[model samples]
Target: MTKKDHEESGLSKSVWSDADLEEMGWHDATVHALFLQPGEMASRLLLDLDYPVRWVPPVRRRDPFTFWVAPATLVFEEVWDLEGSLDFKGLAPELELDGIHRLAPPDGRAEYPLWHLEGHAFELKFRASGFRQYFRQAPRHVAGPMLEYADRGGCAFTEVGFD
Candidate 1:
């Protein structure tokens, strides 16, 4: 949430140590990125990269509308962990902008909950400086690395350190 908090909690702390990640069956540089386009457009990005990712239900809300219409946002948090890496820990929930589904596709007049899968694996972590900044302001969207996700899913992850 707050950079100051992350700095203070030692969650974002950097501790340099000698550790071989590659030798332990762990890879970090390979990034599998998924960008869900806006709802105005019709499309879906499905790739057989590495881990099959599940679609987490998006958070939504309703606002006062005088036009007898509603607007909603389809949000998704996909996660992956780097095994045998000593630098990072915990499941990292990467935010994804799933298409906003309306009562009518391509139309924003109708209100509806966004649809997403609960099972899938991602090949890479999403990092957009703008998003980080936005979440920093909101504080509620605070998310760490994919290691947390792996741990939560009962999957094994590793962390390596380089000194």
Candidate 2:
């Protein structure tokens, strides 16, 4: 998803930007991002299948800890960069599940079975006209354990260390 498409998809373009993300300690290549609907809130954050969910306020934070939205249906995988130049890769001609837009994995990554790679930043779009916030766990904190969790699905566990 290009920045243009991301913007056209209903994300608050004015609120989230590369500079804003940088100031908040995020880069364009942050791992997969989680989304929340307007006024939605959660008390804890789950990084993946392994790490135990920790308490964190889901609302009123400037890019709170890149938490996971449970029930799995709200998470999204993006193949674009928010801090880069505009991409004109127009939306796919076909619309699935009604009017919802889905992004496809790029080139070599197509071979990847998962929806998208972890650690490449997540793009959260609004479900309605309301405030939506996002934050991410740095790769140093999530990569190893999260990958282990994904591989195990549930049987295995990954322990995380605090900074």
Candidate 3:
């Protein structure tokens, strides 16, 4: 589905609007986990955006502009193809997201656009009909110093927050 479709369907209107995501680019976002299901039963890819981006706090605090990290999950639906390599041995690696791009489908056979996700440790190219992003929880206010150590361990969802 297109951006308008998602908006009209109220799929991404809860926590993030299109303008919000446009302003807060995916650069430097940490990928804490990746779940890809490619089969007749399910064809989708889910990415845990650990340290997505800095957002203004809803309520003002001592520091007028204290930084916050809003963790979210990005999902690609109706995935027809997926190809990539990720290391999943001892512990799940934290892949620093570089960027996400929408490109023309290869060979013009697919019904949807192609998505290319570039990261510091991995690269993925897939053809998906559409995608959506939703926050895992309220934006967690974090200290400026803590940002440096945010990705030092497993994802907040897997390590602590999520059950």
lDDT of each: 0.21, 0.24, 0.60
For candidate 1, lDDT tens digit of each residue in 26-141?
11111223345333323322221112111122354353211110011112222111111112335464332222111232334222222222222322232111110011110111
Question: How close to the true structure is residue 145 of candidate 2, measured as C-alpha lDDT?
Answer: 20
Give each model's clash number.
Answer: 30, 8, 0
Best TM-score among the predictions, by candidate number: 3
Candidate 2 residue lDDT tens string, 58-123:
356674453221111122222222121222256432111111122343443542212212222222
Off-target runs (Cα >4 Å) in candidate 1 are 1-4, 7-33, 41-148, 152-163
Tens digits of per-residue lDDT for model 3, 54-114: 6454365656444455566777778866787766567557687878887888788555788
lDDT of 3: 0.60
List residue ranges in candidate 3 displaced over 4 A: 1-24, 38-42, 55-66, 86-92, 144-163
Candidate achieving higher TM-score, 2 or 3:
3
Angstrom error at residue 99, model 3? 0.9
TM-score, prediction 3: 0.62
